[model samples]
Target: MEEKFLKVTQEGHFFDKHKSVLIAVSGGKDSMNLLHLLYKYQDILDIRIGVAHVNHQQRRESAEEEVYIKEWSERRSIPFHVSYFEGTFSEEAARTMRYDFFAEVMKQHDYTALVTAHHADDQAETIFMRLIRGSRLAHLSGMRVVQPFASGELIRPLLPFPKSELMNVPHFEDESNYSSLYFRNRIRNDYLPLLVNENPQFTSALLHVGKESELLHQALRDLICHIDVTNLQDFQAQTVAVRYFLLQHYLEEFPELQLTRDQFDQVLNILEKRANYQHHLKGDYYLIKDYQRFAITKIQPKTDRQEEEYVIESEGVFQHGSFIFSLNEPLEQPDQIIYLQVHQPILLRGRKAGDRILLHSIHKKIRRYFIDQKIPQKLRDTAIVIEQEGKIYGIANMVASDLSKSAKNDIIKATLYIKMKE
Candidate 1:
């Protein structure tokens, strides 16, 4: 299936030598075959390969499975990392821990990409799962071959491969998959077989549907990503359909905000009416309309106690009430973070008058900057601003000064997050 693997890689833009990949292995047939194939072609593909395995320790054989994968990695001289969970795990908990481990492995090992062995059957199962959940096509299309990740791009090179193709590989069997105890297991083992028996090509049919879903996503992405935002007046005057796609594209870059259906429609309404409105979405998000523009911001709750500013003297994360001021992860994108050369006493305080930034070679007053960014007027006065020696280093979502623009290698960065009141 080397040709099949090549077809998927070329089709998905999955791998490259510049970015190292951390393959998630479970010693199961699918992941085993994936690791084997990647290892076989590592030199030819000009990519470095490593392994990340998580032992949730939920089962009796979990440790044995970890040892098996560890020995497999060592025998091939491949880099490997394993994380053992310490707490009880629900299915979602296990999944969360697994991805969390994947991210940590990537960061600690300097690997820039994550590879998962979710094959065609898994894709079909996901589609079936989402269909029953009454999911929208955006959520129901199952998994994409490529997705932007904080660590790097997550790629599924086996989206086109089937379990039957990988079964020949030597692997461990976790019989939990066949057990009807889990909901997915019931779908896979009980319901799907009935459909597959009726139509042998059912999985292939679902694969085609997934491919089309991706095409639609790509088309919308192309239309939205390069949209003429420079002509603000003309752009803002566009139809609601245009603004919907704009928000879709915006959400891809900022994953923290979970925009719900009501919130999204409200966003479009705000764009159409050009008025003041505030609607709370999940994740502490308040979709606010600022005249002609729309913004997603967080509200600091009011209590009998007064809000206090924080003195951040070192590279660390600290929280004061609903506000969290964190020394952010190392600079990822240039525009995403600010740099500091020294560890000075930085005060995390509310926005102040005359607080201006020289952003992108233009001097903008903080009030004007907030207006330009469409920050809600209420949030503008109380927005978090990081300052040192009377120089505004960073605002909530901006690297304020041109001088403080972080270089690619800069590690000192900071961010502010406001937790929504319960």
Candidate 2:
């Protein structure tokens, strides 16, 4: 395996030895093997390797994993990039965050490629799962050895071996992997076991299918690589594999967005003939087909505030990505409440360019307001703002410009209420 690794590493011809790499570690034996192997052959490979970890914070031991990985990197004098995410999220969401962090780290730190620990067993399981799900042959080819991701190459060199052969490196197992909640879990626990019981070489057989499918898939990619725009009328006449490959390439740009086999078929069918077709995708995006061409597009994010002095659209509850906003009359009990007056109309949304507000009759810029409040930059990008007329009613609980009390005669105070949904 080591010789094979070295042979491929040289034949691939990517290393000047000066170029650096980023390894995605999950505190598992497979990832640990990747780290250890890279270190073992670092001198010969002539490349630098850095480590990165995404703490999904899904399990009780997730923090421990982060610490373990971080300390291991530090001990080896390797650069480390780490991030934390809150709440239990879907595997798709977790994968998105992981890649997002990896990309950010690569761009910020100048890494050449991101390496992962996907191996032959993983590919086999993935192929079988896709098979049971009725996936097309091309789609069942399993993970690629190398692909462009986040402006850098995402390479997996361990696909030649399974976890049993990766190493005996010390690592922790994620208990959730043993759970029955996930389909992949069932595949691993039930399907793979049953197949292997019938024939111990079942995984090897699956891998063989993957290799053949991948060869055919690559051929389609090479053939279609020259075709710029797929004509709607002729798309259906093409081989099913060709159409599937086109959609697969289209989806590569957005790894977070995924389509099942049925969904993939539906997209192709809709694009081939259906006019005025639109499919809403996850994460505020959608696929729209115009005439002969189809493209993935983002939904224009809705905001309550359209322009200066926009009146409140309604006095009812308004929900944005993660925050909830509402308007109410001054209540008897108030906590974390900002006072506002019944001005023109009110609107709530994130801050925009050139957004200025008046607080205690003092003019303040929204950008400066977020900085002064010590709100993190990412959160500030989506900070909820309450605005009326040209003045800011509230800057996300920081400043609530009093607009209701125009004169001393007015006693009742209107209120703007905001809370982040958990």
Candidate 3:
């Protein structure tokens, strides 16, 4: 088993010499095996190891497992980090919380890699679950052996080995693994055993399926790697399959936005149909189509003061909503600029109901102008307008009405810069 471990690590290029890796130990059989093996081989691998554990606090043995793992790490003189969940969470939520804690530990402690003990059995189960749940091909392939995660790489050195091959080690077994409260537990305890009894090599067959699916998935990913999804013309030029994969790859960056097949198809359809379409996704996020480009943006929540006017009597620099106004000096990459001959105090504010701006001797409603210009509603809501003496002067970054750009020499020169969204 030790020789096989060395071979797997070597072939996978799991770690570089002299790099520090953080081990995710849960006091389970798999994680314990991984912790001990890495400790035993650290000298040969030329890597340092630290331990991290997250107590989900679901099972009765949770506290005992946390203590056991911490003591084990202390005995080996390895750095240890532990976090306890505040309350009971669903399985999905718990998994997310667990990884979030792991990521925090990695970032704070400067660990170069996060090593886990996911073996072939875990991979097989994951593939089976995803398949039954109707997932995309990429998701159905199960977990990757190594992927960029947190501050470094998330590596699973035991992926090639079956669970039966792991040597027996003293470890705590959480009873939750046998409970039906979790979908994975039900799959592992009930359905999987039945299938294995019927066909002894069923798990191996699923592993084979996972490997083939992953190979195809990687091929699709590589095919769309050169296509930029944000560039409308370039993205439209790709084949349909490539385009789908490109969108999938783009959404993968935002793990919080989960879309079903119908919703994903709707996005693709919106791209093909027209511009200026805003589709609300989960939370405050929206998929917006500008004239020629599209992007996912989170609309800022509205506040009571979002529409409040700022009285700028004489400004050196003033911030109103998302725009920064600089008086008499040029700013790098100003979104909009206009010269104003100030005879009265000017007001900087967002658009209000019944707002109209004078452009080329014609009055146009601010709302109509925005719609005609194909500006997204989210941007229009926060669009800053310059006003003086009960008349609208300009909508910053979109238009500077003829009234705002006066020819007078006694000028209050102003430049508008929009702040980058957080």
Compared with the true structure, all predictions reach lDDT values of 0.71, 0.73, 0.80
Residue 64, model 1, lDDT? 89
Per-residue alpha-carbon lDDT of candidate 1 for residues 357-410, written as tens digits (9 for 90 to 100): 657765456667777778775666556676676666677554457656643236
- Of the candidates numbered 1 and 3, which has the greater TM-score value? 3
Q: List the residue pairs that clash in candidate 1.
A: none
Q: Which candidate's lDDT is highest?
A: 3
lDDT of 3 at 111: 86
**Where is model 1 poorest over a 10-residue stretch in terms of lDDT?**
413-422
Once superposed on the true structure, which residue ranges of model 1 sit more than 4 Å away at CA?
Answer: 6-13, 17-19, 225-236, 239-246, 299-422
The TM-score, computed over Cα atoms with residue i paired to residue i, of candidate 2 is 0.60
Clashing pairs in 3: none
Better of 1 and 3 by lDDT: 3
All predictions: root-mean-square deviation over Cα?
A: 12.5, 16.1, 10.7
Each candidate's TM vs. the true structure?
Answer: 0.67, 0.60, 0.69
Q: What is the lDDT of residue 128 in candidate 3?
A: 90
| Model 2 agreement with the true structure over 275-360: per-residue lDDT tens digits | 76778766676876655445666645545433232245556665555555666733234334655555446666566543556556
